[model samples]
Target: MKTPAIAGLILASFALFSPACSQAGINLENTRVVLAAPSKEASLVIKNSATEDLMFQAWIESADKSEDVPFAITPVLKRLAGEQQQVLRILYSGKGLPTDKESLYWLNVREVPQKSREENTLQIAVQQRLKLFYRPAGLPGKVTEAPQQLKWRLLAKDGKPYLEVTNPSAFHLSFAAITLRMGSKGFTAPIDMVAPAATTQVEMAELPNGVQANSLKVELEVIGDFGGILKYDGAISG
Candidate 1:
């Protein structure tokens, strides 16, 4: 395997670690990787599920797609023979990242299949993209508490209802579902995730009949650090 460049790397939308094998027959042990300031590195297990040979190339890119990345990956490119697994380690630089909040990055692992011996056969190179989080040594609250610490409210723009939220924690919290619960009525908002110390607003779904907007409870399904879903009971601010 040769050193591959980040340039011309095709990326998939997004994927989580699962027991099901991928199109390229590659599987990751974890959905995401996290590196703390107290730690020097993190590792991921990459496995080739197929019985044939496959080439896997792993790389890191900033969440904002910045040119400068403060991390490096071991075995940037490797050939994994049938049903074999390899450990890919990610090393973080001591500096160049903000300590005030968790930084987000992407780990892109692309599977390069062996050249086709059959004539005119199609071979698709599959790539798996997972989220990577860089956390500082000391944060105000726990990662599990981030979802409940968020400030949620209902805002109106041009008579259209919108959901507004602010993250007070240094950790980035993602919401899989946000619902405004009322008496026998529920109006779900399409808002997904919010950044740390960031205020985000998204237009909510239309209010159902007989649903009162004055007293509404916020029900959030948060995505935790290890890819588990957690429930949060909250209320809108006055």
Candidate 2:
């Protein structure tokens, strides 16, 4: 089982590792990348904070493993000196992608450190992945409002409790954590994402003993525009 901290680090676009971890030498200026409508491309900035020169390779792939994504990254491979920064441009081909809703992709940045021949020493390569959101023209609601537009409900299936969440808006709702409160008892669901105009169910576990699922209040901490987590509160529908 994965801990909440580890799961958050994986789903979150922001860098969660501390600077004391020398392996985490590359710093990203922005945690989330947004390509708005009427813009052909978006840019991301990466910096090398370590004293040694670092080699980096960046690429883009569909986060949901969809086929034929229409995005490309420039300067696929490069070397950055200490305290130096480089810009990565993501150009959209405007093909094989939807124009009615926001699309999601993952921007992977792999760091290769120069190998040392010293005995009894270890070197580790670091790979960072961030979210890339492609926004089309004229969506129903703003991306920032996605969390508030989610529909939540609690149901029992196969003798177990499950939380049903539906996203009615045109923006993807990526949640960092979800807390469901019923009277004096509360439980947190794992991190997950609900696609635009889609619904997903999460199995509830570790719930308080003898707690009822009906009339539960829901609180969600969702990923924001700048990679920070924002809170939203709502009640579960019957």
Candidate 3:
């Protein structure tokens, strides 16, 4: 019989030759829209599957009815690991809304790779419809009174994402143009606003990587402010 040291070496060699194990993966869960008690900012949840650990990143893009739209990342590129999940949030403000109300959007989630290569990278993309409308809240010349609440909704239109804004104030809050700013990428869209109670939507642009999808970051800009200070929603990429 072989000595203990020789036997140990043989066992170690055999273990090294063992095949890699393929574990099951997790699915996205609990994706729903949430609105604050008296605010326009909304929060959405992204749950992961219960199988293997995962890494992911988030991004937003513009969608057009008959053309390829543009999109950008909020934080450039990011990485996520398995068994762990992250929450991607976006703030909705009415800006350059299309009068057509037929625009769409695609929210993308991509998986990061343990090793970097063309074949090993995987991506998952979710397409949503966008509907955003806004109107002023509070009466004009009422300085002492609280501003009326601006009603906003990130709607799930036929299993898609959309937004609408409602203004309730006497004064007109101009929401003329919308600019989608992601990382160093920018896209401008022209639109008109209604006084006191206008409803409209802006279509989303296509992602950078076409159908395959990748990790990315995103931010939304309406007229002047950056969606009332809520910025950036993202995920991991390979």
Worst 10 residues of 2 by lDDT: 1-10
- Model 2 agreement with the true structure over 1-238: per-residue lDDT tens digits: 1111121122122234432233557888888899987797999999998887888878887865655668878888899998899999999987767888889988888776565544333455677778899988888777787787788877777777777888899888777888998777668887578888898887787764344646578988888878898998977875
Error of 1 at 223 (Å): 1.7
Per-residue error at 188 for model 3, in Å? 40
How would you encode candidate 3's per-residue C-alpha lDDT over 1-238 as one tens digit per residue?
Answer: 0111111111111123443332224344433222222354443334444344445455544433323333232322344344555555554444443332222344444443233223323233222222222222332443111123344433344444333445454422334444434456644433344344455554333323221113223233323222232222222122
CA error at residue 146 for candidate 3, angstroms:
33
TM-scores for all candidates: the values are 0.85, 0.85, 0.30
Candidate 1 lDDT, 88-109, residue by residue in tens: 9999978999888999988889
lDDT scores of the candidates, listed in order: 0.79, 0.76, 0.35
Model 2 lDDT, residue 1, Cα: 10
Cα RMSDs, all models: 6.2, 7.2, 21.2
Candidate 1: which stretches are off by over 4 Å? 1-23, 208-212
Instruction: Report the poorest 10 consecutive residues by lDDT, candidate 3.
Output: 1-10
- The worst-scoring run of ten residues by lDDT in candidate 1 lies at 13-22
